[model samples]
Target chain A: MSNGAVILQNISKSYKTVKALTEINVSIAKGELFGFIGPDGAGKTTLFRILTTLLNPDSGTATVEGFDTVKNYKSIRNIAGYMPGRFSLYQDLTVEENLSFFASIYNTTIEENYHLIADIYKHIEPFKHRKAGKLSGGMKQKLALSCALIHKPEVLFLDEPTTGVDAVSRMEFWEMLKKLRSQGITILVSTPYMDEAALCDRVALMQNGHVMTIDTPNAIINAFPVKIYAVRSNRMFHLLNDLQSIPETEAVYRFGDVVHYLSHSKTFDPLSITRHLDSLSHTEITVNQSVPTIEDSFMLYMRKSDKFNISQHDN
Target chain B: MTTERPKVIEVKHLVKKFGNFVANDNLTFDVKQGEIFGFLGANGAGKTTAIKILCGLQSPTSGEIKVAGFDVYRQTNLIKRNIGYMSQKFSLYEDLSVSQNFEFYGGIYGLSRKQIKERTSYFLEKLELTNEANKILKEIPLGWKQKLAFSVAILHHPKIVFLDEPTGGVDPVTRRQFWEMIYEAANEGITIFVTTHYMDEAEYCERVSIMVDGRIEALDTPAMLKQQYGASSMNEVFLRLARAQSAEQ
Candidate 1:
């Protein structure tokens, strides 16, 4: 418990027959920018609710800032700032009003913590008189972040902050998170985007109520056990099936314009794949070794865990 | 080969303004038959506005537009019949069962009882959701719901389909599978107009148009755009264009 700013010891929760979380154990260090990377139904929201003291876990215990979530719920609420996935600000309230309202809730004034949200609030300042509901998607996200930081909480939890945001705005939002982290704020953010995993200091790749793996983005990519090759041809539609028919091919899936092919035998020759496709009348074929991305690592981990779960069911 | 295909969607100097704000400004493009066209832009960049006009959901302020050979201004009902739309936010009813939702959408599209029944069974088997037909939609996984929504959108055999961030929060494997489904549909001569925030998905499109501040800044093949921008990936190219817009403001 003393090792990190936030710690969970075998936290598990269930909603009726649905197991939203199972034996989730993670320790986030103080001032670390941690990411929970997963798709919907992965129990990210459930885990966040437990950490923020909004819901009690069915079993096990969790701690934030040396306080038990259940026993010290009030303290956790004071020190932790949470931005839910959905927009929670008052729709009729202007941007300035929302920020000041949030500040008042924490017994602080916006002027007292203006520096904390200055970089982000400035983006929405031009539209300070505009109603929150009238703001654009990107502007709404910034205002939400500003309100969440107006109270100057030590730990910030951003749940799917960039879920529906565009690529440009998503990039800009991440830059704000990086800047906040430099101020020694412990940030715990969750997102379903695999590409954003690379931007975090560390990430937990989760699926089906389980954390598949937790490590630095580079570490996870480097630890991929198999080599991958990018294969493309003029007929990409048929290239997927053709690559899978090869005896050495273990997995084949389309990645952008190319098909990522993994072989059962690592020492397999690349020329053999090209020759096979060539015989199948595929023209302008290019097969080259490619580095595995975080998305690739995530897919591989999900497959492994799925097989493990199936074998357990068999037993 | 692609040039030989007929145009399914054509826009000439399209413009849509809300009071003083211009949501879409002088947009012009053509979507060829069976082509998968990607519409990309930053938030508040007029993509939704342009899409609304193209789908006949809203009247354009001024422009010449044809969707599936139907005029946007005069033949809105005909345009609606020839196009299918699916979005991540609102595609299926939560309380309805899997088959019930299909039946409802099929009915809305004016399919006969027999056609609805046959197509419902066909798609359920294709998605391996035959057993889950009686199960409620909210009970299924998000990935399955997305796939089912896509299948239902095309049940009426519309000539063109518009997808708005269809795979926004889906897992990587499921996302790829959805793209494969898109490919299969396009092979059958369905013109697909898709908008996605994923730059990698942008690379999968036959061609893409990036909008900046209610106007198109770049329109070309992903390969050509990357080469022109001197960037390694579509993500870099987007950042260069979108960032340039913000820097000027």
Candidate 2:
């Protein structure tokens, strides 16, 4: 009701006995790049489906571009483009055919909407005649995005668009999205990769059908409550197990070659941890205090939410 | 440490072609034992074709290749016996119980009944999944299933293991745990040959090779590759190479 590009008020959904969403409230501004980040089975897809008018919420209301998802669904559908988490375009159809088909559905020609998807379409232009099924992973993602944008929708919903894409392709995909946003399209993307959260203007971190936190990636990361240290040793396999044995170590998770040791004590000394690893016969152990990234903040939030939910259930 | 490690795999002038399209063009590389070797490439960069050839899944068009100290051409059966393979997609039967899947794979790998039992218990206990061993694979979470898949892959004590994007779609914490498992395997003298799209993971490997347009465009430690390309990260290094290839095309 506040005239945001998308608004959800106490939206709740359930699939049989499983609650998929619980009192979810989020507001995204016009032309903003919004991200929904969580792991698989975090109800990200369910929320996206409700917003795109593909599915209905069991309670409360949701709107996209000022149109009600349930009542004015047809109107919402007309102005929204959705690329599902999984590939959904016509596999047997050529890339050009798929774009034309989507364009025709909106009562327009591909040439009329070419400008909207020109940047993305040009990548797949060479394979325009190739069957969609034969396209490479990165090429198929481009094709799907092109088809979705062929109708020139005012809002775009991309669910896990870069889930299995390569690092370079992922960067290119995000660049394309940024261009679309600059052209005044409101975008809501969902992804499981926490690193991608940094690319969004705002992100909602969700788990177990609940929204734990929503803010700019920097704000969320800045609000991390604990100290995280990157600790590495010549013996990485044994380093993890030995670090986990520390009485003060809260969490020991590996990040590439180094293990991130989370501690609840702010007065923690790096030398003490290194000394302990050194005693364990580890060589060249290096422990450095590190700033928290999105992943670290997410883990902290997820753990806190779980504890809160458990205590509430007990009461 | 590297000087003491022996070479477990060697490929010389590897060439694989489908009709006129060259999939892998004269690729040559050596993977050392007990090292995590990263095989990186963009999609459709012929990574899959080269991996297929290495696993003896397909006959190379023309190449001198050896895997696990056995010739890939005439001694494929011997080569296959000394390696483990896992892909991004779950390979375990959904309906089968965890123990059942382990047993099935054990039979295929020619493990003795006694050996299978010991290996199954050791792995399940190591992963803290002993209680869930009787549950069907469909009931387990994806992170647990992936860990289980990796455990089953190396149950036969293969000298080399090939992981094809084994951590795709998993959450970051789970991915971290999966890599820890990988490090444990590598510590046991298992040569890990992995293909991944995640750039951060390339940094984890002791050595990495980036394939571009069916050729090994770069090969070195992640630090060396980044330095050579004048880049900040493996992602940047890959972009430089991939963009160059696209410009040529």
Fraction of native Cα contacts reproduced by each candidate = 0.81, 0.68
Per-residue lDDT tens digits for candidate 2, residues A113-216, read 88988898998898899999999888899999998898889899999999978777788899999999999999999988788999999999877688889999
Q: Lowest summed lDDT over 10 consecutive residues: which window, candidate 2 chain B?
A: B169-178
Worst 10 residues of 1 chain A by lDDT: A306-315
Please identify model 1 stretches exceeding 4 Å from their true place. A307-315
B-chain TM-score for every candidate: 0.98, 0.98
Check candidate 1 and list the clashing pairs: none
lDDT of 1: 0.91
For each candidate, give its TM-score against the true structure. 0.97, 0.92
Runs off by more than 4 Å, candidate 2: A16-19, A232-238, A241-247, A274-287, A305-315, B230-232
lDDT for A214 in candidate 1 is 91
Residue by residue across A147-217, what tens digits does model 1's lDDT show?
88888888999999999998888989999999999999999999999999999999999888888889999
Candidate 2: pairs in clash: none
Which CAPRI quality tier does the interface of model 1 achieve? medium
